[model samples]
Target: MLNKKIVEKKLTSKTYTPKVLKELYKIFNLRTKQEKQKLRKILLELISEGKIYKDSKGKYRPLKDNLAIGTLELTRNGTLAFVWTESGDEIAIPAEKLGNALHKDKVLVEIIGKWYDLPEGKVIKVIERGLKKIVGTFQPRGRFAFIIPDDPKIQYDFYVPVEYFNNAKPGVKVVAEIVKYPSPTRNPVAKVIEVLGYSDDPSTDFPTIVVKHDLPVEFPEKVLKEVAKIPEKVTPKDLKGRRDFRNEIIVTIDGADAKDFDDAVNVKKLQNGNYLLGVHIADVSYYVKEGTELDKEAFKRGTSVYLVDRVIPMLPFKLSHGICSLVQGEDRLVMSLLMELNKEGEVVDFEVTPGVIRSYRRLIYDDVNALFSGDKEAYRKIGDLKEQLFLMKELKDILRNARRKRGAILDIEGGEVKIILDEKGHTIDIIPRYRGEAEVIIEEFMIKANETIAEIFNNFDLPFVYRVHEQPDPDTILQLKNYLSALGINFKLPKKIQPKLLQELLEKTEGHPLRSSIERLLVRSMKRAVYSSTNIGHFGLASYAYTHFTSPIRRYPDLVVHRLIRNFLKTNGKLTKKKIKELNKKLTKIAVHSSKRERTADEAEWDYTALKKIDYISRHIGDVFDVVVTSVTKFGLFVEIIDKYISGLIHVSTMNDYYIYNEEKSILIGERKGKIYKIGDKLKAKVIKADKTRMQIDFEIYNEEENKSNIN
Candidate 1:
């Protein structure tokens, strides 16, 4: 009874709470504090028994307060903020009080404030740390070294002792891990795990980024060995219990550089004048079963990442590029969804079957577009498949109409800066790539397949991972409307706003100076697409049901769908209640992971592209061009150069003439001269300077009347 009271007193006391004592015990085990304090600081986080708390001044007070658990999101300034799971409220902790907290650490954060605005916290216990490896450039600093993180979000440079360098030098990029980060230390101590080579090494840098982000570079040795042991040729076992479609003249339509094909199409005009369209997806589940090493690896990867120059696939190359890839002239396993559609594009009849089929040809987008447009050269190349090609075009248009009518967000084909590389993988030129009708046709076909499969699960009353996008919040929409109105654009607010209204606004803004900017705003207003087990429907597709079921080769959710469909189809035709519940939970977790990975990949890709574009423009410094006013603020007018397509600021003081900014109109009006510079107006400008490192371009308006005589 005395011991219990002592323990209770310790838990509620101001110093060394029960949680902290447990953590201290774990760190020390059976030793004293003097002995444990000498060890590295990072290893201290391994003692996850403590709670985090907040002091009076919005600062962390570790060991002094009870731990409150929350997920940590660290800022570049080294401050920690986390959302409390119980209240859905966020609190900030200053860097000084954070102790050894790292970004993405889940810790017990003790709340201190009654109000939301000034809430403070201290981390009581660290539930988890982001165990993901980090990539950075290492620099030797006398006796110790520090690594400048590649990810700008990672606020702190890791402190490394000279002994831990493993012979790595300054200016070299490397992968490393935090060894210790004690409360008293200014920087986290780390050890170089791998030297990835110099910054100029493109291949190594790209792959290192891939690895550092926890993206799989290659298949696991065991998985690769397993794939190799599988028979190369189609056998009787592979053909057993499958529908045969060997005689069908099916073909795959993909990008010119596409290697792994997951979908093939066959559309024919039936006797009733309705179309019979076959959407055959490669049955990867047949080879990669659940609970296997391959399945585990695929689940971990979540989805394939496609960068400008390369692809980081979820599965091993042998399976993703070989066995499961829908290559031409090869019999492959498939989960077939054959639908009979009338001229109105309504499904008349449908059949789902496990099947085996052979692809007749691999048709690239350019050749297909030429063939569809009656190009004789394309016909001369593949004259025999004319009838099938015509059917595909018609079917694709029907599906497109169905999608657009259902209120799918339609985006204009944006310019893609393709980084053309030479033999040594050095950037040669960055050319813009346009999307053609062929690409749209493939997209329409894939959407149809995805929707059809989603409907199949809905009919079976099975829980599945859905690709969902919720409607924009009313506040966000109102804000967007106000932004548009301020830009001198009349975007009328609907009584009840719909996706169609936003789409119409985008359409109206086409060819305007603010087209891309406005489109980006609208996209930003909309909720990010995410994976969810809950059947809320897809707001983007305007569908009552939606799931990613067509891209199993690249996406793990699709694989789950494949497994679920096959399990139910091949078994007694009903999923057990328990199994369904378990799948729901599992898929929900997968949805979160897949969504996170998608966002991470997007950020990385955007960073890389933006860097390259800025670097390219830096070459032609001080060049003038026509500029468009994107935004007019009280301080300055944000302008985008026409030829370079880069943004820069023109400060108010640099306007030369006395001007007053019209806040409501989002325009700048010269008071004395009465000259107006608005959001969409074109202006002549001279490139004053370019800062490549900061990605800033300085411009001075041409001031035609005043500066014309002196400039030339």
Candidate 2:
């Protein structure tokens, strides 16, 4: 049978050499017309799937032959695009070679030659359009209208006919769905689907973003109906066959604005120099059964998107914020992971069980952090849970230390942004999100729980979904090593790279002035953490087995994890080999879908947050602020305002003197004055312009002397 697997096995078994159709047929030992036809069809199918590519000479070969399928990544300016191939090679695509492919479009690129040592390719086919609709501002043209896309990488102003304008007036924000994709000579055409009031209206932000990212805004009617049927609170029948932890002092700790409390914790200093730590996560899987409308919607959303203004939930509010939320004093069903750990923070034993719990108290991060800092009022609120709170802190420290010792990268700072809004829904401030002792405690406890649960499933060799971050590509690591050597740092990379190697390098550069630059480069060298059915292990965490087990209310993977745990418990871990085989296929699909949706969520969050950041910057135009140079390119410098936590560009053209880019040092130097601007360098800059439609902010070097001269 000439199926995909058989063909793949035969083709990959030996060294691949470019071959023609007749040669392939001969190789397959097919003489009959029927067999030859089947072979040809199969080969065509493989080509469509990007498994094989036809060389420019009309010979067939595997995709390794200078051709690959991946998303098209346009530069911030959108003049050039690059595609990171499946093999991790970044192939540059020139504007003319793009062939109408938009940014983030899944595309097949045919590599014709090399540009600056990197493979340069032209988009041969657009596999899939990344966006169904785009958010832009409506501009009236001669006989039609044009939409200036908010996304910089869109690269074209969409032309809209007067009839398709949907009554949207000039200067109004509108959502446009492309009716005709662009060609080399002409722009794309679109029809306005939604007419948002104006660019400045805050209410339009979520709608604009939701459509832009294809995010599920409202729950389906079927999903809402299912949620409506779900009980408002945990019932007596729900407690059957579940462990009771209601009597224990469990507390839910989260940010002040958190709507759903998913995980709760309680700690006890056990006898014989051990710690009993309990992690109780809301049992979202119980309420959202597989194959139901609710489950389908949750799977589609994959995870909750928390915007600056509101949350786009994965599940309906009736369940996510009601029964599934671990609210204080309310009985809630939970999948509880109880682990007994030694003083060194190694889990000696653990148990996972369906349980019922009533949160004893709800504590916010601020209060807990204040209590840890010896604030009397904060401690007074702690009251009866003071002893347990301190014990939790001790265990948190031990766990963090153990993780550090086990070679996990702990010092890479990735803080969130706290957007402060006023009653008018305008962004007042954007500050770095604070994660104090309480947040650290929760993070450590959740990680321990996830590891413990994943380890148990791995020990049994079960088919399960694992959160994996594969090792960095050898080429990327080599580049990192070379870059560090230029900075006068001798870093050694092993033949087989390991997390410990990079972790040690980070440790050595902990307090170095160039630590941020190093961190940025090191992070770039590593692959993204993603969901996978097979466990290759998470290199960043240095864990042999790791899975997301908490935050079931917000994340679909956690809910699926909960369901798998329930299955394991019901079957007593006696799954047959055949059953596991079946599960492998199902789990693989789930992992891929969940991972894709997760990336979507991340991108949506980033776009929304960036929009708000630009809005905040618009209010402060011409104001001088201290900024740090986060990146330096030949065209400009990217600087983040120190206090506002907003980044903008200081274009090289605006500088008083022409600047030359120092490629080796990755800095910009003035042609005459030789003033150097490099990463981590602090300088004062004035915001020159802020364009919401373009989603861009331009900054210029602020000269105090020039300002005083002008005033005088």
Candidate 3:
């Protein structure tokens, strides 16, 4: 017979099974009878409170809670409650009370206290309902049907009736509106609003995402009719009360596929050896007046959504892509910003004007970059303005250097993946999109314009929308410092880490193997930039004052800036005091909604693109490729395959090497073998399985190469 004390040590030592120290005495024969009896009573009481559960046979497990009220983030296995307290302390809910709550559903929860290693929360009541519809594949069972959501995080399938199928056939992809959510036994009931088609249908996913997010893809009849009443060309009377830039010889720069041109640039040398540069933005507010159908619709949409293949414009096509596009050879309404800068790129004086302009040419980024870089073909198109173009290039370089010194985060080494398409609209291959000198020229000019406008409002003590980003949390910065400290990367940290410090770190990491991985971590620790009436400084741009004064045709904040500038200019620099109070209140509400919608749209688009990328890679299984571990969890290692540009999972169990998770360090280390596989380490992996339906990929390390070639 085995002694009870020996049995307890065996269980604890072999499996590290979690147990309350007091409870263990109840099951084991202690020398003191009184201690045993007391432990039994306490253990029984804990069991009665339902704060713990026993396994199928008889092993006790803690019931996780630690209560909270938070938005639910549902996952395939369970759900996590994301709670933000009044003091801004963020905590995650335990796996138990996730219940039937889906993503973004606000709910109240009861905290059950902490388990061995994780905080636990249990759902009590749903505080708010999510109105967004789910896109999925329709599964029909005789007269009944259900939609298995495309997002795995949506734990429950939506139930549907035969009549609510909306002409959708079995196994077809569709959009279902949830009518009823799940309780104990039942699933969510739904009504079908759209039948997309077979999962393999060409370009079906694009429109599906647009509709799922309730994005406006078409114009309302009234809005279209209103735009039709506007004149096609600028009239003489239209030039009234506007600065005329007709002789500026400005040109619009965009992509070859771009149709709606919202910005134009002009540069000239001043007599004092200073440069006079103008950034003229299309004055959409001048055409689409307030309280009209066109304005209302645009306000509701907030901003245009640009997906991979299509765009959902805020206004009708007649206005967005035609009347106010700043098209070449056509006079257009503009709000212009003129700046006088010394040869060293320091702004001496700046002026904002409500203006009318004619775009002398519509140049693409690639063409302009090539011409600026001394390509003969590009120079031929520029004709006699070569000297002016050369001076603009010098100014751009100076301005770029100034921004770097000011801690502005520039797009220097990052690359964008662009999908090339065939004539029939099918994807051909993935190509890298590069931003050359021309792109930087526009970006530098736009940043300066935004800063100038922000300063204008600041100096006047006027209310306005400012794009702001606060410094990273002290705790997050400390965590990051500790994380990099272990890797021997040291840097100076102020009482609080500023954007300039972050930018400096980024610059230091450029071209390193760990650049992308480390930059991602840094960015993840920072809050997103947003528009606000509050004048908090922007941390990302390292700017004390920043506003969206460049893209008025697309961003609502820019439109507000346009209106504010017009009001101020109309009164001859005397700030309008009467209407700004009311306008500021309205703009605040607009800013909140616009930011929320923008985040939602960004999430949906990224998910859609990831899905497509996974699908494309699913067709090429058994292919061997080099990969980098992008993320690590208890369950698996996520690796991004270089050849396909798709990320997949490598279950930790398949590492086939003895590994130990160092939780405190957020790393996984191997035992016995000194082989270290950390985040950003390059490894060759062969695809073992690819599931398009689940958007999952499985990989195994290519061990054969280990013996033949030295990985390190």
Candidate 4:
């Protein structure tokens, strides 16, 4: 018999070196073909056990040098996970290869294989558990219970002992503290620690999401007390060294729901026919000092989470919406930026300083847009300020043209939606969000301010938090090109993708029926924007330097930026080498933490919005709506309603008749009737099911069927 133990001992020896399979066979003296085959199988088993790794040269070696530690980030469906190493390499780990590692668990992975030339790995050991508690619904069965997690990335239902229920009733949302992690043969064990509320109640939505993402809803006692000590209004002492722009026609333009105004702007046409744009942002750092309890809490939250029905401010409401808010007719301290531009909208010179600004007017986006569109009431409301408004619009157009000329991406909308809820917390309407001229003006001005601030710090060689978006992966772009080609839209794959390349593609499909679909696909091909200590530039904005500096009231990075700017101004841009070194190290940690928090906030908001959308759909079960097939798969077709952009799955099993999925053609043909379903195909689908617990909405094609619900 071939001794597998001997093979293991050989690899674990003090001086054993990596060897090829043939060399290992010779060393083991396996002359018989069957013995050699057995040796190969043993080696494979050893590799699977994380005892060895196959190098690029096809030689087997120990896993020590090939090991990388990172958080095991599981996909939503839990079929796979990825570990992004410190070296910027993402290693794909199949579900079976995870070795019982849960989502977000810090684990050591050994690179063992390759998937399409990308590094693939297996978790060898769990270094640390990243998730402390899980939010889920408690379900009791006789003596034991299970908590089904709200997060889709969590694959296993936690097993809870009867005594550990913590008085949580069945079907209530609860927070479960992880008692023991899951092993290969056992499920995770947890104890119910906190009961949120009834799982199915409409009011429970906010708390559920808050617990699910572990977001803070209330300020700590000390932090609250600290905030109470702050002044209710800006004082003369606070504005002593700051330039005052209270009398300027500075105005804040935002949505009607906006309570906290962070930025206000004023514009002027100078003697040289150049435009002077002044952007004043609320000075949040002036109050939220570093190393304080309030500051610590803000750092932990990283960013404010804006959801369907709530705003989880980074700072308390006192600072976010009161003392720091630049409301109309109130004096507010700010860190201001003044940019001088000629007809071409190029920044000829700029000034960054601390200032005091009183917003002369609070303008809503709709009203401003209506005024620019020649609405008589909107125009009449602004009186003699009409000249300044015209100048502002002109400056906006000039800035927009400059961006386009510099190859900046002009159009890529996020498909945002505004969900209106009734008094009973039921979704009454879902209005698709659109950007008008006023919104665009604010966006352009913010981008310009962010760029200028980043450039200032970069020139001073200071460490700062930057908003970065890397270029899209070449493989993703190639895939997009293939998809477009299949749609008969001939797009040439470029060797180096400039910002204008994607814009051109979007323009080419301007009036096509699949324009939105193509835009979405193109957007996905691009990289996600993130906070980073290192500057890589923002590919989406086509900016060489960019950072968020206007929303200090809501974003922690902006607060940090504000502090840094204050320090620069106070010391005349001079800092000790030690301070710079300390900042460089600290900012890296801040960047990583802020990026993660931002992603969590974004996901939580999406989940809440989707839940409401699903809530609305469930009430109108059996109602048919026009849908366009967004994606075609072997299992089903994913479709989206045109107007509201609500998506649902048309499971293949619901098709009454079995359909043969044609992968190459990206279509499904009915076996009995030859009915075809393909991407971009317009069809009417009846809403069959909407399950909130599972976060699923399902539809079935409405044809000459006996009844609508029969397919369900």
Candidate 5:
């Protein structure tokens, strides 16, 4: 009988063109009626998969060879780009050739020409629209209204009629549902489904970001009911076949504001002078079974989102913060990784099993850091646990040294902005959140556990999701080399680049004036890390195998790993072929979905942070601050405020004299005054404008001499 692959092969070959069903059957030499029926089914499947299309006269043909499938990325200026999913190559699409496609839409494009030495293409068909609703500000126009979308990539404003205003007033933020998609001659028509409120309201900004990104913020009633049925504590039956670690002095170390405690650690010295490390993570899979309402919702969320003001948890609070959380003095069900490491931080042996643990203490990062710094008060707070903490710290240092020796890329200069809000939820201050030594200890331990678990699963040949980070493309490496050369740094990049080369360059430029800018460029040149069912070595970590085995309470992929481990244990460490295949398929889908959701969460968090920073700067208009030039472009100099670390643009128009941009040297030379501005140059700038709606801040050079003279 004919199958989908056979049909595709026949259609793709040049032996025949489009043919009717009878002609296709004859080409394949099918005789029986059943075989013909199978051929028909195969043709339909091929059409559904977009591998081939049926013509108006009912003949099937393969899609154009020049056609490539990818997602359409639209820039703020309405320029379009198509990023191929398979090759990761991007092709430019002129605005006129974009047709009706929207931002992030799944599109098929035909390669046309070259623009700026890069491939260019025209979108032929939009397979799927990326947006159903948009968050924007409403501008009323007498009888009709329009919404200016908050997302800059959305080029067209959605037109709304008078009756579809949803009682929203002009200048009010709203969520507009698209009723009619845009065409060549017309803009998109939409109806206001919700009115968020004024743009100045700080409370409206966060929620607008959430809605704009389509984050799953609320759980369904069925899922809530399921959460209600869960018990508050582990039962005796639940502890069956689980290792008992409740007697051990396990401790959970986290940030001060953290609520969901998923992982706990314990360490002790063995008789052979080796260290035994215990990493106990909450076993959420034991309660949230597959295909359940809770599981579905958790899978949809993928991971907990840590926004500035709140947390949108993957699981409900009852599970994430109550039962599954490894809270202090709480008996919880956990999946633990026990490893025996030599003094040199090499893993000698390891074991993974379901365990019941009772955490003895919950230590905050600040206290632990102070204790390590020999603070008497912090040591007194830890009391008897000081020795264990010291041992953990020693082990962490050993592990870190081992990792560094193995050439792990450590890009660690960036810090998150900590937004502080007033009682009315208005932004008051923005500060940097620094990661201390205590946080690094926890991170090293988790990475070790993840690598250990991934190695175990890989050896067993079981289906599992791995945290894979492929090496950077050669083009990216060449670009970095060019940029560094322009900066007067003589670093030679090899034809085949590795993480070690990047690491060495970073070390050489550690204390340079352009260190931060170089680090930022290097990071941008690397590929994003994501999850995959296949085992691709993690280039950034210098590890052959890696996976997420901790924080099951917050991350859905960790829960999946726990489930796979639990199933292996239940089946006596053996899985059938059928079960393995099913698991492989399931894990693949999960990896893609989880990676996408994680990206969405990251975008939302960044947008919210940018909004808060703009709001904070809005209150300080006309204030002068010291800034460092991060990059010099033809249009302006991009500068970062030294104190606040907030980046803004200093336009060339704001300069006192005309400046000529030096493309080769990446500097700006004042034509009249001969003043020069380059990256890493420090100057003072006064804030001129802050547009909260656009999330932009404008700055003008501050003349210290003129200000001093005025003061005199």
Candidate 6:
């Protein structure tokens, strides 16, 4: 019999390096094949239990004393990077060294080699599994089956017995729960818990993505019941002690397809030649009290997810689209930020208070934009509001100029794709969502309101949630400068990096051939904005303090801000120190949870859009289109179709001659023909293949001369 104690003692004796399996077997003096098998099993058990570790060379060794804890990031090509949670240091882990640790898994890694600039580590133990369930296509092999996961990060297929099929047959999309985790010698076992539908059914894509991302699509029954008990209209009793803005000419400006309205704007010219701007947001905290089922559910959702064809709201429809929504001509409770600003766009004074508002009109951005463009029909539709719209344009210009002077970074080249779906949920067309003057005006107002509220709460010295964006790392900035220099654009980095320097560079390269590419790179160089309990000044906005004070119906953090302001109002600004301390303890957790949920929602939205794009392109396979090379890698060049904005790979194998990648020049060179392809190069290509399951497309360069000769 193989004993763990004896093997451990021998392995720990005097080993600074890993030991191979054959050497371990020889050390144990195992004579028969059966004994060797038992010894291997014991070694595997020890490795799994974190008593030992494996390196990339397939050698086992004892774990080091100082193991770093981090989250594993796995790429589609099976590469791994470990991001330490505490120190923010990154370590590279070879694919072979990651035994059972999956993508995004919290793991304890032991440093094994320091040959490269960055340390290399091997995952010794998986502290927590990131994925508990997976969505995939089932492939039945007679009595048993295997599930190929849709997520490329899951490198292994799941095994399922016949009895665990849950009535699902082959070629069906299903969600499976992992029954047992993976091991070296055996695949992971899973049971089909939900049979979504056919793999070819377009309607199943939404639900499959929803389940895959663990997004909460529906509210709990208890939450729905609580929503049912809430009043549908603002009564006289509900307006007590609330400032009434019913007579104000407030209007909501949104997209044509917008359903839930959470914010409204009203502007008036004051006697002092300044403007009085009113930004009223839905008071969601009024209905959803603390310690209630609705509040619990709202906190869990964190933020509303806007997918391609649908919206998974944080709150129920009864609140998001009904009484709590700031609909036109409806009495709704709100938290209003009224600011008195001078002509220079400086807020002279501001007041935050709970209020009752009745929006006079609900306007779409297109119509408002047309009105500004002097369209007669649009002017007639706007009628008496045209003058106020003109005044809004003036205020918007002032505010925009003020932000520019303060060095707010503006990278506005990219636009979102709006997928048009038929009644059957099939994608018909994809168009870019335009952002015009009206959109910019609304954005400016909301930003001012958010900043003003943040300053108010910050002055109170109370615990609150803030929207923070940290400055980019120095190394990332230097990399951007180097890339720009390589493209023949002379750029210099200031001793102290500021938003102004980047903004000026963007302006200088605005009309350049690589303008869009440069903007994309600069955007990537910036840090992602997130929610935090402590106020870290927003670097991109150039604001000293900021919070999300608008859209309470869709975002939970906004609702929390509203609650804090309301409590301050109710107590006449006399909150006890003990109460403030309790809120600080609670707000910290909420900030972290909300930030994570927001990221998940953004990822889900991007995934759904990509899937729809793949489906859309699948119909036009073999069609040649003009494309621009967005990036070049060792494998191939990534090109984006001109008008369609769909990106695909032009694999090196598709070319007639062999190609070699030049890392320093960021280009691909043909070995025999000496042909070179670099970023921003325009060429024609045919869509050779589109894989809907993988959400990928492949393209080949079009040979125009050959085609012409063939036609003759």
Q: Give stretches of model 4 more than 4 Å off.
A: 1-70, 84-92, 108-127, 165-173, 193-199, 704-712
For model 2, where is the 10-residue window of minimal lDDT? 82-91
Using lDDT as the yardstick, the better of models 4 and 5 is 4
lDDT for model 6, please: 0.84
Candidate 4: the clashing residue pairs are none
TM-score of each: 0.81, 0.84, 0.80, 0.86, 0.89, 0.85
Question: Which model is ahead, 2 or 5, in terms of lDDT?
Answer: 5
Compared with the true structure, what per-residue lDDT tens digits does model 3 show for residues 1-712? 3343354344435454655555565446555877666655654544433334344345554544443444555544554545432112345666566666666675556666664344555666555665468888888999898898777667778889888988999888887788887778888899998888876664667755665465777787888889889988889898888898898889887888886888999899888889999999999889888789987887777787776677777777777788789999988999988999987788899888789998988888888788877789988887476676677778898898887787777744443467665554455566656678878788888888889889888878787788888777777787777656545578877896767788777777676655555665687678878778878888888788999888867766677778778777776556456667776666676676566566656766676666566555555677778887776666667787653456788887888677787666556777777566666667888788865445577987777757377755
Q: What TM-score would candidate 2 get against the native? A: 0.84
Taken over the whole model, the C-alpha lDDT of each candidate is: 0.72, 0.85, 0.72, 0.86, 0.85, 0.84
Candidate 2 lDDT, 615-687, residue by residue in tens:
7888898899998777779999988777466778999998889899988787888989988877777889999
Candidate 1, residues 1-712: lDDT per residue as tens digits? 2232343344445765333433644634526565455322322332232333433343333443334555566654454455333222357776655656766676666665543454787665555676456778889999999987776556677889988998898888888877875345477778898997875555554655564455667677888777787666567799888999988988898988998999998998999999998989989998888888888888887888887677888888877888899899998889898998888788889888899889999999889888877899999987688878877888888887776776677765443456666565555566656667778877877777778778777777787888888777787888788778876677777667677777678778777767767776787788878777777777767777788888899998898888878877777457778988888867766776677667666765665565455545555556667888877888888887653446788888887788897877777889988988877778887777654323466777876777767776
Which model, 1 or 6, shows the larger lDDT?
6
Model 3 residue 434 CA deviation (Å) reads 2.6
RMSD of each: 7.0, 6.2, 16.1, 10.8, 4.6, 9.7
Compare the candidates by TM-score and give the number of the best one.
5
CA shift at 312, candidate 1, in angstroms? Answer: 0.9
Question: Candidate 5, residues 1-712: lDDT per residue as tens digits?
Answer: 4578777887998886889888987888999988888888887666545577665577776878666666777766776654444334567898889988888777767788887756888987776677899999999999999999988888889999998999999899998889998988899999999888998888888778877787878889999999999999888998988999999999999998999999999999999999999999998998999899999999989988888878999999999889999999878999988999997899999888889999999999999999889899998899578899989989999999899889898655664667898987778987767778889999999999999989988888889999999898888888788778766777877777778888889888877766667877887798888988999889989999999989888888999999888887777668789988888877977887787778778888888888888888888899988888888899998888874668899999999899999988889999989999987788999999987677788999999898799899
What are the per-residue Cα lDDT tens digits for candidate 6 across 581-631?
Answer: 888868876786787688779878888888888878787889898888878
Regions of candidate 5 where Cα sits further than 4 Å from its true position: 1-78, 82-97, 104-122, 482-489, 511-515, 576-578, 708-712
| Candidate 3, residue 104: how far the Cα is off, in Å | 5.9
- For model 3, the run of ten residues with the poorest summed lDDT: 81-90
Native RMSD of candidate 1 (Å): 7.0
